[model samples]
Target chain A: MTRLLLPQIGVEPPERCDAARNRRLLLDAAALLVSERGVDAVTMDAVACKAGVGKGTVFRRFGSRSGLMLALLDHSERELQQAFMFGPPPLGPGADPVERLIAYGRARIATVEVEGEVRRAAENSPGTRFSAPARAVSVTHVVSLLREAGVEGDHELLACSLLAPLEATLVLHEIRDLGMSTERLEAAWEDLVRRVTRA
Target chain B: MTRLLLPQIGVEPPERCDAARNRRLLLDAAALLVSERGVDAVTMDAVACKAGVGKGTVFRRFGSRSGLMLALLDHSERELQQAFMFGPPPLGPGADPVERLIAYGRARIATVEVEGEVRRAAENSPGTRFSAPARAVSVTHVVSLLREAGVEGDHELLACSLLAPLEATLVLHEIRDLGMSTERLEAAWEDLVRRVTRA
Candidate 1:
């Protein structure tokens, strides 16, 4: 058996173990920079300084500023996917489906500031936004969760409706344009989940 | 007082009576053609023929194919907003809030094919989608209706979630890419509205 690939939404491309670890460090540093000071702060020098590495190493790993952002987005998305798919309860398989749905929205919202710009970049290209392998996985997960929660009526579309508010694009607007907080958004997600799943 | 202009979302730029009527005729013909044969069939000559006007009139009314599509989208959006805000019963001012929401969603679903493309076109410019005056009007209307319906929890965010499934970008994907029917989407919208608003 060999490793699987889900590359359109980007599964980890194979690399040497040390190289992969190094890249993850840089991405983590970049993500932190973005979260702390916004996407504009993700310069090569800043990411290098934060990661305790030379600028040359950062450039060698990602080629340019854009390359670094793309890598960071890819890394973040894959991490979220892994967390809910294979990690522990609530977001993973062990908890009630309703709780898992709530957890999934909360986790996705937490990533909006870091991952939103690139996701918006992809959204600029019309056909690519909805067709990504990652989005498909998310939709399937939510639909299955809705079924498990015993929610009735058009589970697939309802899942889409539930997932829509958690989208990076919409959440970023609510936060940046409307001055909403992450805490408020998370609480709203919980309320929405309960409303949809309640008997 | 002069008529207030919501031009960014196009609350109708000032126009002479005959020109406005002529424009409406061309737009309606184009709308019908697209609904019958899809957006690809919306060429100037075809629109001109459908509306029983000379081709020069079509070109004069809307400079090009893309221009015509944009106007059609604008016209359609305004009509929906008017219908819900001031037109009549279920979709307008007089009906129950829950019934009004269902009507609103059904009305929006009816316009997906023609309007979805231009809406997707605007969405390519990230800031424009959420910030448009027309979208703002729609959001305000939904929030008010939710409040009127006596629903609980995060009315603004919940309204966004309810409206998200009705977005053209997403609905077009369901119809064109996922092979879903319009009737199904409309019914799903009704189901979703009920779930969110149930006592």
Candidate 2:
């Protein structure tokens, strides 16, 4: 069977093993560059050199710098998505809607706290903050949960409201400017999710 | 009593009646231009033409286009702040935390829904979005309400989470792209507030 290519939307899976290996190398290099230098300083050439690959290969894999950032974000977000989608009971499928929403928030907080840098890098990209596929998926997940929780009226909008708390900029502002603790954030989130989900 | 100008932060309130009237005229003209041609298109000269005032008068009232937009946003935001702080009950002072939160959300939603274009214009300005006195006041108001509701743990962060849902961009996205009804938005907000404020 012939495989199809959708370069613009980036929907195609890995084409070859070497390409996959190179992609992994690029991501690892990109992460290191991001740690060493900020998002602005991490160039495709630097990533290519760090990964011991041609700059052309890097471009082929990621298309552009924004594409690379999105790819990195997608990788981490996919792990998070998997954790909430199918990995365990409370966050996944076994628990009730209220419990699941709570679990989802906790998981999200943990994810943001851990992957703060990556999340910030992705957001720093201009004009693409709300267009990430992972963001859409997360919103859809929350909306579905709100529906399951019996909250009537615009479940999607309500889901957007739920996701509001997890905004990367707001989260950063809270921890950095407001001196908020993870425990405090988690507790407030618990309250918020409970109230939003209650009958 | 002596009036001292606070450098880089506060300005002295102007005293000339005609200046104030012309400023109002300029602001009204700017608002109409914003409603018609958007904030970006409303030039000082255009404002003067629309307000039936001279271009120099427009310049005198507002130093630049940025100044004009700031003045317009400041005027509208002040009214909103006044309404929430001292206008009536529920949204003001007489109601419980839960009711107040609901009222506040609904009011904010309505405001954003109505004045979205102006709000978006104000927010798009560089270096002004976060520092605007109105934004700061709104944050303080929400924080106070969260504390009043006995929302424990990082009340500031909790307030931010609550405020995040009312973001102009998110509200526009929900209503425009998501095709949500205002009624449904209000209902979802009510549900969210009830869930968030339960003891």
Candidate 3:
């Protein structure tokens, strides 16, 4: 026998657990809205309805539409972060470093295809561009991969040079303004990865 | 005989030439201010005094401070465009494609070191990002160089990826937040150029 004293020491507060679940529920609904109807259709009322919660719950969780969009972006980016860090195979682990780099860029381009508007909104600042925690994680991952692949020279800057093309702001522009396909972007990313990692 | 008739047919207007010279003079003063004390030090009053003109002249040429910054950015970018398009050797025409590409990135980094703030202001919107005439010219130049170097891939997108790191927004962040020197950036750029252009 095992005795459970976790609840007594506040291991799980019911109210907080409920709040977290509730917040995730709302975000899931918002993500669905983005995928189904696009980012422009993700109004507060629409999100509330999609989540089957009252409008007050939506407003309480996110102060405004932009706030909701930002939260949604954060959620989506975290999902991507998890995919690369811990998921499986080429994007995660158990793959060649060069292949992983290619997969990572492909995944980033896919994310931009979905959540680009939200990502671009946040990347508007030149000063804060590289300071985001997500960006740091991505850079660290790329640098480590470069080391694993036996590529020489300045890894940090090389990571940045590689990551620059995958940025949502630039990706969105390439797709919308320049009329480029994400397929083409992915192929180009692979070419870049191979070129940079070549012995 | 032909020149005598040309003046009567509205050729080389005196007022327009004076206006063009005045605009150039004010822009020159603003560029000097930028080089000496940075972009923040450039102001209507400073430019007016630096150009030995009245404040009203500066105001008449550029409607506001933001307007002045825009014009200054345009002026500087045009100068760069001219250098790469028609000027001698390395960056322009005579050098090998790979060498020209390296010089172009280095020159762009140098320009960003000086005119970065102004350039970043214009790149704020993702929609208009690749639509700028200067950006188009740069892309065309890079694509031509890639083709000339016989690099096999999507030339347009490869050019875009090559050019992404040279953007003022990313360059400024790498310098300011990441504490990277421009010299290091230039060297890394050369490495990337060689990698992409390798046979």
Candidate 4:
């Protein structure tokens, strides 16, 4: 008996699969360049060379240097989001809300250490600073955590207050301009969270 | 006895007085134009026209539009500094530290409603954002207030966190982009101050 074949629902086409892999490869190479050298070193030609792809492929994927930087920011933000949303322990679901809040601040500060330049570029643009989707998700998460901790009074505004210091622009200034250590920033954040959450 | 003395120390020469008065007049005109018509309407020609001075006088006083904006910001910030440092209670001395802190935030938010465009422009410049002398003074004031309130643990960083949300760029975003009422922001700030100071 002959059987009819059909495309699987909710599945990516083979071309899309190749496209995804290609995008991932370029981003991974860019990330490596940023880590090893710096954000300035992650040029399109460098990413293409590192990814073993043609320069045209890199350009086609990311469009421009800024486009690549934005995608890199989105990629790193998504990873952090996943960890805090689904991964185990303090940043995720298992721990108390206050602890989770502390973890969130720590995680955000850590991101500044790595992705700061890109984040600062995005922040310097007035249009993207507060309106980025990732920022909205972060605000929502902080508000929920504040509610979970039983803190009252304008949780949304409070979340904005809490997140403002962790912004890349400010954190980077503290770290780079003022010579503040990341550990000190993290400890201060923990202290802040505790104080705000104290009953 | 006739005081045949070296020019009285710290006294302006008559010609210098004229120059100072001219500068103040130009600045006041620019400020009035900004308030009545918004920042974009406060051109050099307009300031000259408003002040009843020659356009050359405005140009000679400020050099350029950016220089005028910076001077305007400096003028406004100094006024704020004076108010909080010595002007009256609630915002100045004689009030409780927490009340002063709350007043500080309210004053800053109010400034955003007026001088936000100019302040945001200054903030977007990397050199000016954190390193401005005015910011340093403001930070020192907040840190002292926190200490006076006996809130412990990283008072400097905590002050920064508290001040972050009151940044003109962020406050303007909340007021203009998100359409959040200034009253709501003020109430939320009061809530934040109480939470941080509650022991």
User: What TM-score against the true fold does each predicted structure earn?
Assistant: 0.83, 0.83, 0.89, 0.90
For each candidate, report what fraction of the true interface contacts it reproduces.
0.86, 0.61, 0.80, 0.80
Q: If you assessed candidate 2 against the hidden native complex, which CAPRI class would it receive?
A: acceptable
Q: Clashes in model 1: which pairs?
A: none
Q: Indicate the DockQ of the complex predicted as candidate 2.
A: 0.49
Distance (Å) between predicted and true CA of A70, model 1?
4.2
Residue pairs that clash (backbone atoms under 3 angstroms), model 2: A195-B195
lDDT tens digits by residue: candidate 3, A1-199:
0011111111234557889999899999988887788778899999999999999999998899978876887687778776776779799777888998999999989888668867777788654466766787778788888988999999999999999998888898888887989899899999989988999
How close to the true structure is residue A171 of candidate 1, measured as C-alpha lDDT? 85
List the candidate 2 regions with Cα displacement exceeding 4 Å.
A1-11, A113-127, A150-153, B1-14, B95-97, B121-131, B149-154
Worst-scoring 10-residue span by lDDT in model 3 chain A: A1-10
- The CAPRI category of model 1 is medium
Query: lDDT (CA) for every model shown?
Result: 0.82, 0.71, 0.82, 0.84
Candidate 3 lDDT score at position B40:
83
* Span of ten consecutive residues with least summed lDDT in model 1 chain B: B1-10
Which is the leading candidate under TM-score?
4
Instruction: For each candidate, report its DockQ versus the true two-chain complex.
Output: 0.69, 0.49, 0.63, 0.68
Consecutive 10-residue window with the lowest summed lDDT within model 3 chain B: B1-10
Higher-ranked by lDDT: 3 or 4: 4
Tens-place lDDT per residue, model 4, A158-186, is 89899999988899988888798999999
TM-score of chain A of each: 0.82, 0.78, 0.85, 0.89
Q: Model 2 over residues B1-199: C-alpha lDDT tens digits?
A: 0011111122457669976777777787887887677656789889999988789988877898878877777777766666666668787667776787788878877866446767765544434445566666777777777777787656666677778888776776677776887778888888766667666
